[model samples]
Every structure is written in C-alpha cells, then in structure tokens.
Target: MDLELRHLKIIRAIAEAGSLTKAASVLGLAQPALSAQLKRVERMLGGRLFERGRHGVRPTPLGELVLHRTRVVLPAVTELQEEAVRFAHAFAGAPRFRLGGTHGPLLGGLVDRLATAHPGVPVTTYTSWSEREVAQGVGEGRLDFALIGTCGESPPPATDRLTWREVGTDPVFVMLAHDHPLAARRQISLADLAHASWTDVPGDGCFADCFAAACARAGFTPASVYETDTASCVHLVQVGRAVGLCRATFPPTPGLVTRPLAGAPLSWRHLIGWHPGAPSAGLATTVLGHAREAHAEAVARNTDYAAWLVGHPGFGPAHPAAV
Candidate 1:
C-alpha cells in the first residue's frame, strides 16, 4: 500500500485538531471511516501512528514524522491542482475565483456581499488565523484574493508573486462595559487611561500585536492585568477588573460597548491582496467587484454607525466626535 492524498489529509487534520472526532468533523468523514483509514495508513507505514488515550489520540513519534511529510506534500498537491486548474480554465476560457479572508465579522460581511452582489460567479471562500497562512494561500495559488488586516509594522513578507493594496481602515476602539465610568464619556484618549489596568488579547500576531504596538506608540505599556482568548473581553471590564482594545468593527457582544480611542494614531486597515498572475477577465472582475463593494459598504456602514451612535443616548454625545 502507498500513502495517498486522502491519507495525508487525514493525518494532517488529526495532527492539527488533536482528536479523531474533530478531524472527522473537519474532513466531513464518519468516525469509523476515519479510524479505519488511519489504521490503514499506520499499517502501510509499519508503525503505530497514534496512541489512543483517555482524552483523545496523541500523535506518536512516528505519527509526527508522517505529519511533517504530509504538510509538505499537501501544499505541493494543492499547487499542482491549481496549475491544472489554470490550464483547464485556459482551455475552456472559464474563470474561477478563490477568495480568502481573515476570520471574524469582516470575513462574514465580505462573503455575504459577494454572494448577494455577484451571483453568477463561482466563488470559493477561505479563511485562516495567521498571516503566514494568508500569504501562503495567495503565493501558492490556493487563493486568488485575500481580505486581511495588515498593519504597517508587519507588512506581508516579500512574495515575488503577490500584490497588496489598502482598501479600507477601521479605527481602533476601546471596548468597555456600558456601566463603566469611561463608557459614559464622549471620547477618551490613550492618555486618559494610562494609569488603568488593561486586558490584552492573548495571541502574538494580527490584531493582538496591533493593540500592543499601538499602546507602545502612546509612550506607555498598558499594565496587562489580564490576558485571555475569550470572546467576552469587555465583560472583564463589566466586572470592574480590566479594559481591552479592539477594532470598531468587532462584532457587538452583549453587555459590551466600543468607542473610538481618542488621540490614538493606531487603526486597523482592511487590505485586499491578490496574486500577480490572477485571473484578469470574466469571473475575476465580477468577484473583485463584489469584494470592492463589500469593503466600500463596510466603510460606509462604519461611518454611518459612528454618526448614528453619537446621538443615541448613553453611547456618546449628540454630536460625532472627530476620530
């Protein structure tokens, strides 16, 4: 027996998620089928790939070896598929568009707009957490387009084949509990809360790094009294412990309110990235048109929402404060 794409995919999925059930869920396979396939791969490799445990399966040393190889092989396979697709489209004169986004409300909104506005084009939407993943998708031809938040500090690395452009900017906001003392104020600067304890998003890249960098630029390291990956960082403020920095477009959660960080120079920008060899005609334009419209709509909505919220009792004053 020889290792195949399906086996590689299963191995990679198991390694990433750390459990057969989760791998199965991601791969859309039945538990029994995935287990059997895993066993088959292990038998072919002549080693026990995974060790069954009380919590879940753990990759044995041998499993790690297979997974490492699979990671490399899988990307190559994806590239080959893209190459074949390019040739096929060239012959048929039909264009295919693949779009990627960083995960969150922005991705959802962009996808919604694309589906609604350009119903004729076949669109494949993809998302990942790390900038490396997004960069890889564009560089490897896995994605023709990417909507991402790229700060000036960490520009997407020099991929000779990809191009990036700034489409929109979302100002940073300080999210707090509705009843908090500063929540009732019209606008507050980074200086206003220099002495207050802060809560930070736990990750090291993307939005979390942006928040930390922004504070550092303000000339004071925010005293990180708490750091968590939970969705309800504002609730930490509601309990009177810590406050958090977030983008204005972050989805509104219960008991949390976000306001512009007065005098803070930092704001998250939405960037549109695409491959240099991307589709130039037909479906590509239709897809990009939707992406552009979606971005414009988000920009307009943010502006309108800022204007509407100014006078809406308990949010801010009756006039929109300059951001």
Candidate 2:
C-alpha cells in the first residue's frame, strides 16, 4: 500500500526508456513484472502513472510529476546511507592520532618515547615547513597537535580553538665546520662573522625568520647568504665555504660544532599545541609530558656545550647564555 524505492526506480526507468519492455530490461526484470509493480505504485499514489500505445509507452502528467520528485528524493536517500556508512567506518576503526611540527630536532626522539609510553595508541607524525600550516592542521582536524617555534606573538593554532604549552627554549647556535677558524674559538659574536659568507635556509621558513631576527638583534643584517632548505647547510659549512645556525633540536652531524654568540640573546622557543575539541586521552597526555622532558634535556645539553666553549683551550671566553 505504501510507496517504496523499487517502485520509484521502476517509474524512473520507464520514463527514461519510453517503453515498458525496455524499462523492464533496464531493471533486470521481465516486462510484465515491472508493469505490475508500476501499477501498484500508481494505485498507492491515487493516480494512473503511464499511457500505453501500440508502439510503446509514455508517462502521463501524473507519472512525469512523480518521476521528477523521485529523481530528487532517491539520490538524497542514497547519500544518507553512504554518509552513515562513512561515519560507522571511520569511528569504529582503530584509534589513530596525527601530530605535526616545524622543528625537526625537537621531534627527533618523540616517536621512540611515544612508542614506549603509549605502545597501543598509534601516533602518526607529519612535518610542516611553516607555522601557518601547523596551526591550520590542528584547527581543521588534520592533526591532533603540532610543535613549532613562537616569537613575540603566539604562533598559529588560533587561541579560540587551540591551546599550547611551551616545551623549552634554547639559544640558536651558529654551527661551523670543526676546521673553520671560528669553530676553534671559545666564543664567536655576530660582529666577528658579519662580513663572512653565510648559508641561510629559505626565508619563508620559520627557522629563517628566527635566524634573520637573531642577526638583526646581533646588530647586522645577514648578507651574502646562500639559501638552502636541506640539512646539507651543515655540510656546506663543513667544506669551509660558509657558516649557518642550527637549532639544538636538529641532528648533530659529524662535521659541525655549535657555539654561543659572544654577547647576544637570541633564542628559539618550542611549543606544543592541541585543539580544544580533541580528546585528551591518557596516552596523549603522557606523550606530551615526555616531549616536554625531551625538550628540557636538549636545552641542558646545549647549555653544557656552551659552558665547554667558554673554558676550552682555543676559544678565549664564553659569552652569557643566549636567552
């Protein structure tokens, strides 16, 4: 007595094919069976649905109207089913968390710590080259959290939707090849190397801004700089052509040593952020705590390196900690 999807489908096919026999064939049914189904639908709707001719068939005014309505209704019903399926599948699958960051050194050991602390919670990591992307990713649900450098103003994840905690702060140190003359000095200043050739990473990147800011603070603008985004900037320095600054969180390759500036206060602050809507699972909390500890450890180690530079045989004196 009630209309159903199969009845609506039959009507639509008949309207398109223009013949009962052809419409039945399209529906994978015999002509008689489809005709009976259509008649039942028409009776339920209180109207005749089609007109038969010697040659074929055509829809009546009532049939055309019903078919038009069904065309819109059926696809919406299908979409609802698919959307329900997508929800069930995504939520019912295994738990997965994604985190992104712009700082490589700070992220270096996090995976191991997370795996050890939350062995069951799968954490995926993504690297973003800029703070804008990191913040956007968290706000848009693409990432569960992000770690990045912050200057005077807070970095992106908008404060209304996201919150952050400072992990650690450390001075950005100029890394030079061991054989470079400044590399042998106890402490180097921006003035000491202002006129020297330098290797700079792309300015659009967060590190580049931090580096440029440090140079400006050091009373000089970086000039005659070779721009590179790869870690090879350190190797370029090793070859004795140019010097570059690397944060403590970056990998410590064989050929480079990081030294404090003679009397400069330039530092990069590391922060971790998460969305307000994101779940605070126990594992996430634990992983965040580990990241904070790891950051502190890196800062402490770099401080010891600075202390050694101050008293070392070749370098004359150590400068105050770059705050």
Candidate 3:
C-alpha cells in the first residue's frame, strides 16, 4: 500500500496515544479497522512497528524511526494546508478571521474592537468552556486566535505553532445572595465560605479544579451541590441556595453580590493566543489591548470589585490611569 499523509497522521496518533484503542478513539476509527490499517502499514514497511502488550502498545525500533519522520512530515503538511487555505480565502475575496475562547465579558469588547478596526474583514467567534480546546483550535489553524484563561502562577501551556501573550490577570470573587449576611462584607475569606454549598458551571473542569484547590488551601473541602448553567447558577446564588465562584470582572447580577476573595488565593491570567504565522497577529494584539480595556470597564461598573481593586493595586489592569 502506498503511504500518505493520512497514514503518517495515524502513525503519530498511535504513537502519542500509546494504544491502538485510544488512537482509534482519537481518530474516530473503530479499533478493528485501525488494527487492520496498522497491519497493512506494517506489511508495506516489512516489519513490526509496535510491540503489543496487555497494557498498551509500545513503539519498536522501527516504530520510533517512522514516528520521527512522521513528526516532521505532519507539521510540514499542516503548514502547507494552512497556507493554501489562506491563499484560497484571499483569492476568493472572502477574507475571514476566526476567533475562539471560553466565554467571558471581555470577549464582547474584543469583538467590537476588531469590528471597528477591520470593518472590511469578516470575523467569527466560537466559544468553548475548555481553554485547552480553544488553544488547540488556534494551533491547528482552525482559529486565527483565542482568548484563554489560566489559573495560578504557572504559565499557560505553550505550543510550537502558536504565540501567547498575557493580556491581564483577574482576581477571583465569591458570588452569593445580596441579602446574605456575608455579602455585606467588603471582602470574603475562603474560610468564611467553608460550609457554604457551591455550584459551578458545568463542563469547566479547570475552573472547578482551581476552586477546589483554593478551598483545600483554605482548610476545608467545598460542598459541591450540582453543576448547572450560568443563569441557573446565578439564580441559585440569588436565592441563597448556594454560593458560586466568579471573576472580579464578571458583570453584575441583580439579586446577587460578589466580593473579592481575601488574599486572592484564586485568580486567573487572561491570555491571547494566535498562530505564529497568522496574518491577523497584529489584529490579535489589538484585541488583547481592547480586552484589557474591557476588563477595566468591568471593574469600574462593579463598585464592589472596583473598591477591591483600589485596595489591591497589584491585580487588575496594568494601566489603571488609562481606564
């Protein structure tokens, strides 16, 4: 059988996954079909590429050689495909820029800025709760740029094909009913909410995990009630059914109140990521700047958070004077 780019992709997927079953799942192929294809590939190469074990598959010497070549070839092929698409869109006069990220209030402001700056270019935005997914989309050329949030001090994950810049860091806040006793406080300690039942937006595992870690550091385990939509979660918070975690820049909710977490054990870094070769890199930077402005605006609109920001100048927008 003749080898092709698809074969190389399959080889890479199997090598990375370390198991045909897992690779098949990633490739959207049945295990039996992937096994047959692997057999054919091995027959063409005239040797066994991987050693099959009960645990999983391990690359043999031959497999390692093939994977080394596949790694180089796959990236080149992807670059070629991306370049071709770019050229095709340009030629067709359908210049488009695709943006993706987890949902946040800043996204709207970024879009507005882009629209104002590049009125001639059509733009599209996609939202996913998973920042990793959005980052992957940018790396794979499926998106021109993405706005992702990373919690804690660790830098956001890096990709060879993408460039990432920190736009701003947003302090984490606790959301509770406006009438709740603790809501009157200027700031709330994680310890104060130790016994409070918490609800998180479903499918955002990173945020949920970060919240849990902060709770752990506060010397308690948070009682998780249920995962639900943001609107429902806000409703729950409004009625004192539960407390929720929110960013300082989150828009105000009528019946709910937000207070910064004392000491800021939990915070997130907002990052703007884009393909290194994308023509829209300059535009992406502009978007990042606008996002910072949007975040500052959010701070101004939320008096509680604005006051918190005043006390903790180290966090929030880099240039407060501009805001």
Candidate 4:
C-alpha cells in the first residue's frame, strides 16, 4: 500500500511498544494482524523495520532511520491539519473584515467599500511591507482578505494557499520635485533618468529586481538607489536628492510630480486574495468587485494619472478576462 499518515502513526506505535504483540494491543489489532501489516509495510519500504531479540524487539538500521524521519513528519502533518481547520473556522465568527495590505492607495478604498458592503461587521487592517506576510496572514486565517500587488505579470504571492483575482494594473511612474527639470514633461523616458539617483520604499517583492532589469534594458546602470521607508523616499525626491518610482495613481503632492515612464517599462498589478476554503470564500467575488470599484475611484481621483491615461489606452484597470 502507498505510505500514508496512518502508516507513520502505526510505525511510531510499534517502535514505542518494542514488539508486535504489545503494539497490537495498543492499536486494537490482533498480534498476527499487526505482524501481517508490518510485513507489508516493510516490503513496500524494501527493508525489515524490526528485529526480534531474546526479550522483545529492536529497530533495525532502516527502522531507526525511518523512525527519525517519522518523528519530524508526523508532528508537522498534525500542525498543518490544525492550521487548516483554523483557517476554515475563522470565517464563522462575528461578521467582520480583516484586510492586510502592502503600501498602496487601493487598500484604503477597499476598506471603505468593504465597510459599506458589510455594515456593522467590524473592519480591521494589518499593514506589512512584505507581500508574503500579508498573503501568509490570509492563508493562516489571521485576515479575511489581502490587498497586494506584484510587478508586471508576476504571480501573486502564496498561489498555493490562497485564491487571487486581479483588480487592476497601473504603469509605474516617476515622482520628481515640482521644479525638477523632468517634472514639467508629460512623460519621462527611463533613459532620461539614467544618471539620476533613485529612491523607493523597501519591499520584499521582485519590484527592485524588476527595476534593475528595466534599467539594464535602458542601457545604463542607475547611479544609486536609496532603500528606505515611504516618507524618506518621498523626502529624498522632494528635495531633489533622488527621484522616486511610484504607482501611476500616487496622490498629488505639493512639491512633487508623478510622471509615467516612457513606453511603460514597469507595471504593477493589483490583486485581492482569500483562502478558498474559508467562510470568506463565498464573498471572494464580492470582494473582487469592490476592489475593482476602489481601483476605479483611485484612477479618477488622480487627475494627473487620469489625463495621462487618455493617451495610453491600455494601461489602466485590467479587463476581467485578462486576469
């Protein structure tokens, strides 16, 4: 028979009891029946798992190795089952929204729409720079939904544990001080900023690597990239210390202008994810619809981005089928 968790438990039981007769008693099987099962298991494993001594039985070399691994695997399997149960059960509680997000504008809008969609149910949020952390929270049942993004066509984090639906796409843009030479231009070419210092909020995704690849394609190495928090990145750009790469829908700032990159060298895809087996699974479509609505609002609210999209037809919220 194919090895299974039950088989692992049986092996552990026999190893602990030291003999088939006693193990059979502990496992509620006749001694001969237990012996037969062990033979079959040993045949499948291609080695004897036990050796009879004068008083009892002892593990063979192969048995010792299998037991060592069984010790680690059984506990991990038990923990996984427990977590899966919790993940499914967490959605049954008081109607509430628990959202985790990376730094972005759509999260607040999603919070707004979800609050309105499920009124009286409390709404809570957890923010992390690590997209993996946010996705992990959703998988572990710590959050009901996750609002996260990936660079270009990259897959959303934790595809194995959560279901993801794309809400929108936006061309990555450059943020420059109002008086900076390139700020007045409608669009800035990546090559034009080749010599400029760059700054962006640190993140755990492939965004920085993607940016480096884009810069490589533009035929120049970036002067330097300052990895810091959002406020620091913005401040570096505000004082003309560096230019910040940001979303097209980045809010207008008094001292900065956000401009699209020429030819759309980099893009961000917004995604919403939930554990498919959780109680929140039933609301995935609703959450996705609301996420789209929030993205639309962001596009409308950013006048500079709105006008820029007028000429760039295919660069805004993604089509349903395209996701």
Candidate 5:
C-alpha cells in the first residue's frame, strides 16, 4: 500500500486530464483498471484526491499538493534517466556531443562555427518549437549545450542543474508587406498597429505572451487572425492580411519589410546553457563567443536594427571579440 513512482504518475495524469476516462486513455489503461488504481491510491493516502462532476473531475486540496510534488519529482527522474544514458554512452567509448535549439539563422552559424572549432568532433543537433524545450534538453543531459531565447525572465525551474551565459539581445521588429502603409516608416510603434491584424505562432508561452503584453501597454488588445510559422506569417503579410513579429537576426524574406519597434517595446535575451559537468569551460566559452559574433553579423545585415543599435549603445556588443 506504499506509494511509488507509478502512483505519482497516475496522480499527475489525473490532475492534468481532469477526468478519469481521459487520464486512462492518456496512460494507455482501461477505464476500470485506472479507476481501481485510483481507488487504491486514495486508500493509501487516506483521502479522496478528485471530486467527480458533470463536466469532469477537479483536484481536491490534497490532490493539488500531491500534484505539485509529483511535478518536481517527475522531472528529476527524467534528468536522472538522461544522465544514466549519457554515462552508458561514455562507457561505450563513443560519447556524443548534442546541441538543441529553435531553428533560426543563428543556429546554422553556430553549427558551422562548432564544426570549424572542434574539427572532428561529431555533433548531433535537435530543434524544438520553443526555447523552453531546448533549455530542458540541456538540463536533462539529452543535450550538451543549447541556445535559447528568454524574455529577460529568469530561467525555468529545471535549469538548476545547468549554467547559462547570455549570448546577445535581439530587438523585436514588425514584419509587414513591402507596400503596406506602415512599411514606409523607418520605425513603428505598437500603438500604430492597434488596428492592424496580426499573425503569430500558436502558443501560450513567452513568445506570444510578450507580444500580447506589449500590445496591452499600447492601449489595445492585438487582433490575431492566424496562428502559423514564420514563413506562413510572412505569406500572410504578403497578402496584406496581417503583420507578424520578427527578430533582428531573421533574414529578409521576399515581399516583406521589417521595421524596428519604436523604443524597442519587445526584446529577448539569447542564452547558451549547458550542464555543469558538460565538456570543458573553454568549449562553452568558445560557443558563446561564436554566438555573439553571429549575432553581430545579423545586426549588421539588418539595416533597421543596425540603425537602432547605433542609438542604443549597450544593447549588444558593438564589436564581437574574436573567438
């Protein structure tokens, strides 16, 4: 009758799904079996964890407490599993160096630099939709290093096992059609776009949230008409349907024009993270130095951002030091 990892998992599943049937489906268990397990778990804990309702189930106060603890425990377990795999690979005499991040021009630049610096060290790369995922990969040891974006916020909870170095800051820009009236302006403000439709990636994370908050500060809620990737967003803009957010590091897309936001209402920090035990401090330093260089090149190529950087001296390194 003692609790185990499986019990914790079941608790988390039920709390997340908010219904026994849905939780059973997610866990690949029959409804009856899952219900029986839940009953056993409740008995062991000496309390009811959920209250069944017409809509679904709601966690009781005790259930919330258990779920909170399980959230912490589960990620630690995953990190341990990843570390075991890494150790096994090391013992097998062919340890792999892996890196992960969201897809961007800087990623290609960083990869090329790593290749030239390490010469023969084979590297594995993974891409995710969000910086959070890449940071998690580094923290869990699945990746030896990761480059991720943050809205000047603190790192996530799982990052306790990782060390981070800021690579650069990218000022956010608004991307519009070449002929759009706003495109004629050298710089635009969020308030000017209050009536414009926006196309953004579908996510409740920092990327979307930061833009939304900026819009709120500009005295209007954004009218998001489409949720899609950057290329699709550009297409939407090309058709005169919506405006999209862009980073200074983004390459120019055909039929699109980018302008820096006046006062830089939205910007994010680029960071490189790795486990404390990862390779060598020198390697991490080299990666960060290359990243800064890549960022400088990106800014130089972006005319609007380059102009903005001239007036804003402390945003990023004026001249990135040689790696």
Candidate 6:
C-alpha cells in the first residue's frame, strides 16, 4: 500500500510505543492486525522498519529515516487542517467575534462598536495582562483579533504569522488621589514626583523598565513601585499610598485624577492584531475601522487628553479613520 498519512501515524505510534503490542493498544487495533499491517508497510518500503529485540522494537536505519519524515509531515498536515477549520468558521453563517485583549478601555469600545455594526454576530472577549498572550490567542486561532499596546515606539508583542496595525497612540498618564497636591496641576513633572511611591497594572512588557529609565533620566531613582491588578492600582492611588500609571483615555474615577507627565516621558501605542490566514480575516478591516472609531470617541470624551493631544502632534493613530 502507498504510504499515506494513516500509515505514517502507524509508524510513529509503533516507534513511540516501542513494541507492536503497545502500538496496537494505543492505536486501537489488535496486536496481530497491527503486526500484519506493519509487515505490509515494511514490505512496501523494501526494508524492515523495526527490528525485533529483547527489550522492545527499535527503529532500523530505514525506520529512522521514515520516522524523521513522518514528524515533519504530521505537523504540517495538522496545521493545514486547523487552518481549514478556521477558514470554514469564518465563512460559515456567522462566526462569533473572539477578541483577546490586554486590560484597557479600547477593547470595550471596539466590542461596543462591533456589536452595533454587525447586529446579530456574537461578540466575546478574553483579557490578559500580557500582550503576548492576546497576540498568541490570535495566532493560534482561539481569537479573531487582538487588542494590545506597546510602550512609546517599543515594538508590539512578538507573534508569528500575524498582522499588527496601530489603532492609536497616547501619552501614559499618572493617576493620583483627587486631593493629592499634584492632582491640581494640569501636567506633572517626573522629576518633581521623586518622593512619591507608584503603582501600576501588572503586564508582561518593558514598561516597568522604561519607567525606571525615564525616572533615571529625570535624575532620581523612583520610589517603591507596586505592581498589581487594575482595581488594586486604582485603590492604591485612591488612598494616596501610591500614584498609578494609566493610559491617556482612562475614565474619570470619583476620587482620582489622571494627568500627563511633562515631556511625554512615557507613552503608549494602541495596536490591533490578527492572523492573516484566519477565516475571520475578512472582517479585519471593518473591525480595525471600529477600533479606530472607538479610539476617536475615547479621545473626544477625555477632554483633558484631547487638550493634551492638541499640542502633542504625533500621539494618535497613524491615519484618519471613521466608522
């Protein structure tokens, strides 16, 4: 019989199991049948693939060569099947929009716009503190799109076989208690806050290091920095225990205020990503448009950020977009 994918699987199973009996058990075939099948494969290939040995079966030189090829072929075929499934889902009546995001306001805004634009399509979101995780979800077909950010011209997460687009950009802002002394200032100087402790949402990025470098440039080592969840970061800032680092579009909190840092010492760039081969890729442009619109709405609603943007020419999407 010609060596087909099934034949390759059988060879791999036997090699992995180390014996015909174990291989049969794993492959759900009777031992005798498996042995017979193996004989045919060996006969077709013109050599003994496995040698009968005291301990178990070992691959012959021929077996080793075939096994090497099997390893390469199996994964490629598996990937082909998986990509086909993703394509099918995209073309099927309606594929749910599976969005992966690092915690932020842009994700919610995009979801809202997508739901309104594609009325009947179901929408869901997966949140992670790591941009890599969000990007990975898209690359792995678990998510249709990824919403993530990079710090001030830093590259986006490293994910293979995916396209990343800049949704927008904003200067990172500082969050402080409403009554904090710096809260009254329109913009705070990084050097001036040398004595203050800080808090920020935890993430897998170089932002923490970048913040440190920014502080170093400002001529003082920063005080204690607490990495925590968003809620904890807010509470820390609320109680005046620490100041929080936030995106420019961070919504107003009753007891907290967000202000930009002078010189735009730290900044963030919003990014949207997706696997180009995914079935859902067809909607990427549309979704990107919505993301841009969401970002614009965010820009409009945050009056302080809007005023800040007026003077900071380079901190927004690379191009104009509307939805």
Mind giving the per-residue lDDT tens digits that candidate 2 earns over 1-323?
A: 77888888888888889899898888899988887888778889999888999978887898889988999998888656644543443465676667788745667667667777667978788886677788777665667678777643335446665677666655556778888787778668888887777885552345556566767877788777787765668768888888886664444568877777665345566777776555533245655677776665555556545454344333211122211
Q: What's the CA RMSD for each of the models?
A: 10.0, 15.9, 3.1, 11.1, 4.4, 8.5
lDDT digits (tens) for residues 1-323 of candidate 4: 79988888889999999877888999999998888888889999999999988778889999999999999999788558747766666646677778899988899999999888788978899999999999988877788899999999888888877889888889999999999998889889999998999998778889999999999999999999998888898899999999999998887778998988889989998999988777777877888888898998899989989988888887787675654
- True-structure RMSD for candidate 4: 11.1
Task: List the lowest-lDDT window of 10 residues for candidate 4.
Answer: 82-91
lDDT of 6 by residue, 40-126 (tens): 999999999999998899999999999999999998997786687676666678568999999988899999999998899999999
What global local distance difference test value does model 5 have? 0.77
**Tens-digit lDDT track of model 5 for 186-283:** 89999999998998655324667777788888899987657787678878999999988777777777898998888888776777777766443336
Query: How does model 5 score by TM-score?
Result: 0.80
What ranges in model 2 sit over 4 Å off? 1-92, 152-157, 203-219, 249-251, 280-284, 300-303, 306-323
* Reference-based TM-score of each model: 0.59, 0.61, 0.86, 0.75, 0.80, 0.75
Order of the predicted models by lDDT, top scorer first? 6, 4, 3, 5, 2, 1
> Model 2 residue 195 lDDT?
72
Candidate 1 per-residue lDDT, tens place, 143-237, comes to: 77777775533566434556765555556677778777788875677877777787745432565566666667777777765765546466686
**Best-to-worst ranking by TM-score:** 3, 5, 4, 6, 2, 1
| Candidate 6 residue-wise lDDT at 156 | 76
Best by TM-score: 3
- lDDT, candidate 4, equals 0.88
Say which prediction, candidate 1 or candidate 4, comes out ahead on lDDT: 4
Evaluate all candidate structures by whole-model CA lDDT and list the values in order.
Answer: 0.66, 0.68, 0.79, 0.88, 0.77, 0.88
Query: Could you tell me which 10 consecutive residues in candidate 1 have the lowest summed lDDT?
Result: 314-323
Provide backbone clash counts, one per model: 0, 4, 0, 0, 0, 0
Residue 248, model 3, lDDT: 84
